[model samples]
Target chain A: MIIMVAIDPSYLITQVLNGLVWGLVLALIAMGLALIYGLLDIVNFAHGAFYAFGAYVAWQTLLSGGNYWVALLTVPLAMILLGLFVESTLLRRLYGQDTKFTLIFNFGLMLVIVQTCRFIWGARGKPISIPSELAFSVNLGILSYPAYRLFVIALTSAIAIAVFVFLRKTHVGMATRAGIQNREMVQVLGVNIGRIYTLIYTIGICIAGIAGLVASPLFGVYPEMGAEVLIPAFVVVVVGGMGSFHGSILAGILVGQVATLPIIWEPRIAQVMIYIFMAIVLLARPAGLFGELGR
Target chain B: MLEVRDIHTFYGDSHILFGVSLEIKEQEVVALLGRNGVGKTTTLRSIMGLTPPKKGTVLMNGEDITHEPIHRRAKIGIGYVPEDRGIFPGLTVHENLTIAADGVGAPGGNYEDAFKFFPELGKYLPSRAGRLSGGEQQMLAVARALVGTKHVLILDEPTQGLAPKVVDRITHAIKGISKKTSILMVEQNTDLALRLADRVYIMRDGNIVFSGVPQQVRDNEEVQSYLVIS
Candidate 1:
């Protein structure tokens, strides 16, 4: 008797696509965290809270009969305003004093925001409907995929390109990038370092907001959902290295694959795979994959 | 156009400058000369508001600005080129030149002027500052200061470690720049100080030991006493 074991190509393709999409989202979060840490020297533990807030904002917009495109614009704007207010009133005071104060303050902020979200949204997770036009799947020669997932990939790719161009081509972006290496040098040249700090923080928060708003439909909007992504995103940041942009992107993809691919064979060990990878990488290269020592 | 009067700067409990006073006229080049760690750089730092003096005043063009921030001091026409040159090692030469030209009223918008001052920097405009040679870095530091609106340019040890030819190149550029903008330089090389400065002050143990023209300082026997290795 001959026994045949079948391998499903569609399953593999779906897993790979899922990994890529999730990796891009994680990259967005990690990049924002890294940018804030690099320029303002703040670890921004409240970053995930900002992401959750963005999702809530999107939910509110959608509830008011706004389309996905409208929520897309409104979420980032709302987050930017909140970021500016928080930065000027609270975070600004902690700067130049102690990093520990900032870290604790951000942790407090995360708690406060998560609690506020819980009080408003209640214990039940809210389901967000995908846009009517994007509800269908597109046939790609081998497998059919959701149009919205492709849209997410395209949108993130565009944002990544824009960010790369901004950092490489513009004067302000170049100064910001240079400031990460040496702040005093930028200051002596007469650039007000404080103003740059505000801009960097706001931009970082806005990016987090974007990630949250987009992911709300896929992952039901819930209060503690931020923590679910936050833990793994921190892992991505550690694997990418502090203050390293390209490092975070590569590490995010690696992590997404490690987190998702194992589920096909054995679902139990999927979560543990990322930590094992991180530990091995840290042991081999303490500075992270592309991170510089003593940053 | 600058006056630093009775400045007493301190670094924590250890006092660095004791009643140090100096003056720089419009378009004049004043050099502060001393051996290592005699508070020459401290005086510059105090004036630039990096390590502000506890008891003293710094006046630029008649406005007292002792408590001003470092960037504010730069905005008010005080361009400080520090000892280490303060180059943004990751940025290109062109980016370094343009990063701080946000305000108006200083003579920093002329690319031809910067290129005319140091032609060697032209080739390195696209290269990162960390790759440049010592002389080129010094030229870039001075060039960055001049690119913005700055009336009083403060330089600390511009030729500390360089080939004699590079020193000549930097000194020649300073002389050219000094004709247009007032300069306050700190130099360990007494000959270079005397050659470029209209007036010279010798610092010793956190105080101005002697102040006179280069010839008077060269002739004074007391100057030798201050120069002795501690």
Candidate 2:
């Protein structure tokens, strides 16, 4: 059965809005990935699993009659704790070792976490009802859209701005940024490089966690949902320069547009469009759009 | 005061320093001179705990600190200005100095004094360090290490690649800084080393072949043969 696609103004506006929200969500995940890679020099294959884990934590909190706002705050914090545990238990050992060691270790971690979530939450998808305050539609002169979608976009933008300020204005943030450039130099300057590594890893995954928590109501919570976003996040990181914060956000939005814009003309082709776009961009820039050579 | 006694260091099983030992007294400027690949840098690395010595004692103010990590050594008042200068090119000059100011060392120090030492750094505070001239970058590196009130400053090839005028400027800065804290330096420019160093130790093949006052080192033929004259 053919599902008819419409190209009306309202439809186009709605798609663009949806794409923006999804792009920002992807940006959130990719930013963490980029930060981790930049500082810790780890690809963090288990990031998506951590994302799913956060959603599950949010689901658990909400299911226990906790407020939506509380779950939103608590979920990322829970993810940070989980991140700390994961770092100290596993990733810490892999630091300063061969890159392949972390790659294989995190790959194994992804499987373990995915399987653990399946065992706990079951294989079926779980739905989280949108908060009542955000259930209404928002009208913006030219378009009417779900208020929740607007909230997601606003929240992500705020987070991005906050991160920018933290990295630029604060002393700890400066040390972290310095560590990204030269870990040994930072260490010799009396900055605890080991602690910085743990903090960055935790912060990275917590951002992923927040992305999962926010996306759960829209996308549904499922064990394999993380697997879906994880691959796209990889694409986003590649399309963006590895370790560039600006590059990840731009690439995420670009991927988001490429993924959805084509759906108006041909629904079937939209799925592969992102990959094709990535390939084309990579062919032109090689290291990615903003990727530094040899980074 | 700082002391490294019979320290042995390795780079992945290839021993780079064998039983290397040295001493710096209070407010003394000591220079380590050697030909290329003779473990001058390795000695600094061992003292900094960047490459922990396999066997030996490192003493800071008469306390054993051989097992301390790099940051701990810094916290205990050892400031290292590395061979490459170790400037974060992506960060601005102000950011570079700010990071070191945020670091732990002698208390009650800030970026103002650093800028004062290298007045040229004030103009480039907003510019990325990578864009700075080599002399400007070296100034920034040294200024970064000196941002805090450190007890001991270890400089590895502080004037490795700089113009004569810039080298003279750095030499003047070192003279000013040496009055505040003890310095252990590794220099290729023997003339500059002799000028700044109260005493000199010459290393040959990871071992100290000569240790004497600057005038004594200037008079010795054996140590002169191992030195890199500039």
The prediction achieving the highest DockQ against the true structure is 2
lDDT (tens digit, per residue) of candidate 2 on A172-220:
7788889878888998888888888888889888999899989999999
DockQ of 1: 0.55
| Model 1 vs. true fold: TM | 0.91
Each candidate: how many clashes? 2, 0
**lDDT tens per residue, model 1, A2-21:** 21134477888898899888
B1-230, model 1: which lDDT tens digit per residue?
A: 89999999998889899999999999999999888899999999898888889998999888999987667876777888999998888788877776756422232334545677988888888999989988899999998887655688999999989899999899989999998899999988888888899999899889998888989877886785676564
Candidate 1 ranges with C-alpha deviation above 4 Å:
A1-7, B8-15, B103-110, B220-222
The true-versus-predicted C-alpha distance at residue A281 of model 2, in Å, is 3.1
The TM-score obtained for chain B by all candidates, in the order given, is 0.94, 0.94
Scored against the native two-chain complex, candidate 2 gets a DockQ of 0.71
User: Model 2: which residue pairs collide?
Assistant: none
Local lDDT at B217 for model 2:
81
